[model samples]
Target: MGGGDGGDDSVLHFVFVHGASHGAWCWYKLTTLLDAAGFKATSVDLTGAGINLTDSNTVVDFEHYNRPLFSLLSDLPPHHKIILVGHSIGGGSVTEALCKFTDKISMVVYLAADMVQPGSTSSPHDSTMAVGEEDIWEFTYGEGDDKPPTGMLMKEEFRRHYYYSQSPLEDPTLACKLLRPAPLRALNGADKLAPNPEAEKVPRVYIKTAKDNLFDPLRQDRVVEKWPPSQLYILEESDISWRRVITLLFSLSRLPYSLIFSVLYLFFNYNAKLHSWFDHISSLVHYIKKSYC
Candidate 1:
């Protein structure tokens, strides 16, 4: 499943949404894999993230931060539909997009993300804040000493343990160099993720990381129970396992939304044999196509 034969040239696009303090750069590996499989993959940098020139301090609210995704969706061809994948707090932005452009989205996937209720007011950063003040670097740049912090970044010392403990050494190193300060106001703003009827109707798939340090397994379970997805797959690995998990997940694209449940359940059982699982899964896809597709 690392690379497709490029035999199917249909326009199946994947739009990846990165987590807080991260950028489009983080999705490099996954996007490359998707592209190899003859699929179109795009990763967007939220305002004040990635190479976007917007200053982090000036990002006033969640909506402001999500402008890039909205603009991309608005400009897409009417016949195109996308698979939106969100990681961590990017789930909020994904939800916002779902509410606004429900018709344009074919499916939504949340990977160890903040899959909160439609009108939840709690900040997605609440979990990070619980990690203790020492693990973060908060700043009030350009503001007086009396004002609240304008931006925040995970302290370099704690970044590895909290985010990349199970990842390769090089991934954490790249993150340290590229990670930027997340706008504090925007993350902690009063904006609510209010979902509409259309958004709720869209098929959703939630992927949980068993060893996720930032969003623990318990929290992931709670969110899933609150708003159950069309299908759920738990990776007995780290938050960074998208690189390995995405290959099999994308292969399931040929099956219609209703047919993904049983196939996904089988994927988790053979996840340990990830390297060779693709061939088996590819055969499974052929069978599904013959029987259901």
Candidate 2:
């Protein structure tokens, strides 16, 4: 993904927000790819997530968990606007950012993420919805079992099936080792954001991971229908892991700027099909950025 627009225009910076139970570490491969292509990328570890050193149990609400992101946006250069990319529940963080820093963000990209609309209290696929009552993970925050869960960590046995069913074996292996307990209240119990017309003015893009087991594909369709994005692309048969779905997001260059479509299944219909499409998709890396920036 070589990302120069053939001119001296300001380089497009993509600020990546990872999903639940994840940290800045998850975006390692994507950040490297963007940097090599001449684009700037910063992946922030939300409070208690990644290596932020905050305790998840103490996180009281969404605002508290999202403090790091708010700080990062607050400190940006005045004229520089970033393309905010959120994956899974990270979409909630993106929405929070949109409400607070609409001007600093040029576009919001939701990758297999919760495109929670205004007035909605929680994500379409919150922790409870994603895991259900199955003994797939453990939830605790030092409080008694009677109280609501404050943090959660997925069980190793169920991790592969839910999050990385379609990804390479190594991807899930790495995630299983590195995944941390996410703050439950911070992710699911946020108060509804008051309507902000400015947030609507900013362009939004939703990239669906059709094969994602955690966030149902049908729910993704409903989200798109509810708040239609400027662009929508679906990664067929790809799981939530970047190893399988990152190429599809990186391949946005092939799409025409003026074309706003409902659904486009662009890559990896089956195993071994991704390489054939990569050559074409990677040919141009800054189509959307070049047009927008």
Candidate 3:
């Protein structure tokens, strides 16, 4: 990624949240593109997803996923503002984070996200079902299920239909390697996130994937209607070919490794600067925590 603009004093921080069955790796391509465009992008993994994966039993709630993001946001650069971009179910997490750290955020971009309304019992979209007839995957909800149930794994055949159907062509190996059982609690959490008037006043962008099987075009339109975005774009129409898709997916999958190595490099080569920054942020975090309490 390119360095911050030397002339402009204002620095932009982009925080990306991925959708269901996806990790931070999915934002790899977008991060690269944003970096080229002179913005700093950080693709985050929810508590139970991506590099944060631990025992499934431990990640059975929404707060579990939210805390990690909160911790990350708490330590951000004081001079920079954040732009949160959430895809699919990630929108909810972004919404929750925004509620807590509204002062730190500048904008929110929902890419085919689940637009939840306040006091709504169900999510706007049926997250369990696949999009088209070509894709057949059953999302089973147990009896008396209030929050989205956990422990459900996607069938291999269904995975082939939905994710790998478009890109990787007949190559299932890449898709299989990327697949993992997503935490159901994150999907079914009861916390309500309606359109905040304050948030609506800020800049919001929505990017719709035209060929998406999970989130249909009509559903996306409904989301846009309820939470009108400042800007919209169609990915497939915007020269986003199959090769590009593969490249993007590959990059998103590798973000954790990149972040790890980046931290290691900083620790070894710039330990003093990194420590100084951490100490500064620690004081800020303490102040913010006390004030909020």
Using lDDT as the measure, the top candidate is: 1
Candidate 1: where are CA atoms >4 Å away?
Answer: 1-10, 132-134, 238-253, 258-283
Which candidate gets the maximum TM-score versus the true structure?
Answer: 1
Query: Per-residue lDDT tens digits of candidate 1, residues 1-293?
Result: 11233444335678999888899999988688678656678999999999999998889798899999999988876555587989888887898888889988988888778776577665565753455444455565647677877888878888898889887899899888998888877876523866476788888988888876678778788778878888888777443334445565666666666545544444334455554655666677778878875
Residue 144 lDDT, candidate 2, scale 0-100 = 75
lDDT by residue (150-207, candidate 2, tens digit) is: 8888778888888879768888888888788888877765436777888988888888
- Candidates in order have lDDT scores of 0.75, 0.71, 0.60
Q: What is the TM-score of each candidate against the true structure?
A: 0.85, 0.79, 0.68
Worst 10 residues of 3 by lDDT: 259-268
Tens-digit per-residue lDDT, 93-170, candidate 3? 887787777778877777667655444455643642446555354344543457455644557776655554555554
Against the true structure, candidate 3 has what lDDT? 0.60
Ranking of candidates on TM-score, top first: 1, 2, 3
Clashes of each: 0, 0, 4
What TM-score, to 2 decimals, does candidate 3 have? 0.68
- Give me candidate 1's TM-score against the actual structure: 0.85
